[model samples]
Target chain A: MYTMKWIQQDLQQYVQAKAYVDTIIVPLIPFHFSDDASLEKDAFQREVLSVFMRELEKEFSGRILLSPDYHYLKSADKAEEVKRVRSWVEDSWAQPFHHIFFMTVDSSWKKFEQDMNGTLIWLPQIVTESMQFSERQSVVHSQVQQVGEFIRSYWEDDK
Target chain B: MSEDKRPVSRRQFLNYTLTGVGGFMAAGLMVSPLRMAIDPVLQKEAADGDLTNVQLAEGDITNEPQRIDWEIDQVDGWYESKVSKTAWVYKDDNGDIVALSPICKHLGCVVSWEGSEDYPDQFYCPCHDGRYYKDGMNVPGTPPTAGLDIYEHKIKNGMLFLGKAQPREEA
Candidate 1:
């Protein structure tokens, strides 16, 4: 059910079962090649966000379609980017996704959250590299659980 | 020394040479197919590494399904990483232990035991409202086309060891 790796056969399946798949998860990732200091942080966020997205997809694969990552420059203007982001959500409506979510670890996206068409979920970035392996896993696991609950709450709101 | 040096007739030479070459060709032909036939047994032994000890003891499982998490090392192409897996374990009416994979059959979402207030005593998937029975059978008219997967399990030393979850055929 993960749309991240789209094959023709899966696409056909999705098309046939389009009514059941109502949710879409769009991961917003920022890349920074401008400075050495910001580069490492951006890279870490990308990896962590990927892990989070993968887990979330696994949790809600039946009802959700994971979009190919939406990458933007780290230094880009959020106000200007809102238009493109909203356009992406609008395009997804062609597939008729009811609940579109933009998941990101970047806090700056919070400013334009209201401007975006879908729900803009901002998660705090975790510096997992320095943390112990098990500790980092536990942290990510708990966060994923919380996020799963949050998504469920949205579904509950509809009923 | 004299007997060893004796010159063989052309027929004897042909016989020995043909036998040596034929043996080499026959061995080369048979080895690959032989390995292919035995390969599954070898892989099964390797797959035994998948059996993991879930911390909960055999005595602790109740009628209510409990979620169990365990870490396993997964090697996916290049990256070797630790992946956490989950299973819902409980004792059935007949007092036999059962473990089910949470992944929904319709579109692969995770289902929770008695998740929805409306659907009591049933596993519910929040995604598309898929439902499964207590025995992991998919409820008809629900989103799920097949039943939930059942994990292969064994009890040793009073501890539960679970292997992979095998998917059930359409119900």
Candidate 2:
């Protein structure tokens, strides 16, 4: 089992070195906004992501891997948007880093599943309504532990 | 002939004192404007000869990007201003350390690393699609005309220190 204590320490270190990680992560966020809407949210997202990336680089150097954040798509949108996202990831993200992790949040999941091409990690929705705060914490702890374990196992197997 | 041979009369003494006071007043009146005019000239001369030495010890090089901020006194015509700038320091592929300026030369926009999906592992300028390779060369056919400026670097002890980025001299 992945220990929460270890994950927390690693995450703390990651946050401390946000600038380096953000150097790689900032340009990936979807930035389209309506003329009527304020760009504050998008700006904040960029700033936060920049900081996060910098910290990641500082903590993990080039060893830390990153995947694009899931882009939630609705049925109403055209296929072009989906294709653009995939192309962006491939041309921009994958070219730099060979491996990426993604979570699917689309309604059909078929398009995303196909586009992800086996690179997707299906994130199960945690039922927060039924769970207490402590339970939610435990769930998060377990999830991170699993992630760490998977990374370790993958590294070991590669060797 | 043996005793007092003081030659100044009272009128001559008064005239001398008044002339001295008048000269002092005149000089005081002219001082501010003269200082205002001469100050910039002196400052420019000082700025032209100004050179700051930065010390780098051997230990400062790590896997992380180091932020280094510095100021240089620059003279623009008659005005002397301290130009403040920063650089990100990191180790390149050859294991030799380098410092790259955060500022983009194209339209003075700031370039951040990994800014766009189209160009990964390179510094990006979001304003005009400007791109810089990892070694800080501006991508050809991009907005930037010149490569990213390289700071003067030296190693002392166990640390890395950087100086100002001057234009590349032809060897």
Predictions in order: chain A TM-score:
0.91, 0.48
Task: Write down the C-alpha DockQ for each prediction.
Answer: 0.49, 0.04
DockQ of 2: 0.04
Task: Sort candidate 1 into its docking category.
Answer: acceptable
- Candidate 1 lDDT, B65-170, residue by residue in tens: 9999898888899999987789999999999999999888887778899988999999999887889999999999997878899998888889999999988765
Model 1 pairs in collision: none
Report, in order, each candidate's fnat: 0.79, 0.00
Q: What TM-score is obtained by chain A of candidate 2?
A: 0.48
* iRMSD of prediction 2: 16.2
Q: Which stretches of candidate 2 lie over 4 Å from their true place?
A: A1-159, B1-58, B63-65, B73-80, B169-171
Look at candidate 2 and tell me the lDDT of residue A2. 9
lDDT of 1 by residue, A19-132 (tens): 877788889999878899777767987998988888777787777778889999989999888899988888897767778899999899998888898898899876457888
- Name the best candidate (by lDDT): 1
